[model samples]
Structure formats: structure tokens, C-alpha cells
Target: MVGFYNSLYNLAHTHLNDTYELLTSLQGRLSPAQTTTLMQSTSWDEIIFVSQRSPRKSSPGLDGLPYEILDILIRVPCFHGLILTSQPVRFGSCYRC
Candidate 1:
């Protein structure tokens, strides 16, 4: 039983590492122009709509601001400008049971 558990843990750890590496490589291949175009083409209305669709009770992101705050921020014109000028977004690791 213990050996089985150890093998399972190792397999999961390896899979997670591989997935992260693959994502990093893929992101590196995206050109600056492509990223800029994507950011510029995104509309504020679409962002707000996605935010509205998010679960209200979900935990806050790295900024520690909840979805409700984000919803309010998206309504302000300056918020959209801030997002457009901000540095490229980074993804944080999430651990699940």
C-alpha cells in the first residue's frame, strides 16, 4: 500500500512539472506583436461580462481583490486604460487536492 501511494505521488509530481514546462515554452513562443494585438482587441464589455459570470464566492487572485471589486473596477473607464498599459499577466501555481 505504501509503495502504491509513493508511486502515485511521484507520477502526479512529474505530470505537474511537465505541464508547467510545456506552458512556459508555449508562452515564450508568442511574439510581442501577437500579445499586444490580443490585449488591444479585448473589449471592456467582454471583460466585464466574463467577470460577471465568475462565481462570486471564489477566492481572490494574486492581487487579493475579490471578483466583486473587479466587477466595480471594470465599470470605470480608467480601469481599462490601466489594464492596457500594465505589464504582461503572470500565472501563479495552484494546488488542488
Candidate 2:
């Protein structure tokens, strides 16, 4: 049991390190125009709900809304949008939460 947990921890660390390296390489390879386009296409609106309490305050004209409700309202749509993107979420033996 201890061995299994240790192995999982090590695997998670290795995966995170590999991800960081890959992202760093990808960042270096992007052109200024491509970076600008990427930034423009990415949604900042979703961030407002995640980082703030109210989605109404995010866009204006709203009520006493909890972040949990705001997540259901906007965050689910953002997740579905990500699923429809070029690089969809991979679900398999490769990654586990």
C-alpha cells in the first residue's frame, strides 16, 4: 500500500515536470503574431467567474449569486467549449486524478 502511494506520487511529479518542460518549449516556439492571436482567441470571461464571486459583476446587471451557481451557469459551457477545441481532453490510463 505504501509502495503504491509512493509510486503514484513519483509518477505525478514526473508527469508535472514533463508538462512544464513541454509547455516551456511550446512557448519559445510561438511567434509574436501567433501569441497575440492565441491570447485574443482564449476567453478571459471564464476567468472572471472562477476568480471572482459574481458572474453578473463580471458583465454587469445581476443579483446575489454564489460562485457555485456561477460555475454551473458559465464554467460548464467553457468546459464543453474546451472539449470541442483542437486538442480535446484525453481520458485513459495515461492520466488519473
| Number of the top-ranking candidate, with lDDT as the measure | 1
Please report, in order, the local distance difference test score of every candidate based on alpha carbons. 0.67, 0.53
Distance (Å) between predicted and true CA of 24, model 2?
8.2
lDDT of 2: 0.53
**Each model's backbone clash number:** 0, 0
Model 1 weakest lDDT span, ten residues long:
88-97
What is the lDDT, from 0 to 100, of the residue 86 in candidate 1?
44
Model 2 CA lDDT for position 79: 52
TM-score, prediction 1: 0.41
lDDT of each residue in 1-97, candidate 2, tens digit only: 9998898878556777787888877754878888798877545555554446544435322344455554554455545453234243354623122
Q: For residues 1-97, write the lDDT of model 1, one tens digit per residue.
A: 9998898878556777787888877754668888788767657667677888898866445656678887776676756775545433446853232
Number of clashing residue pairs, candidate 1? 0
TM-score each candidate.
Answer: 0.41, 0.24
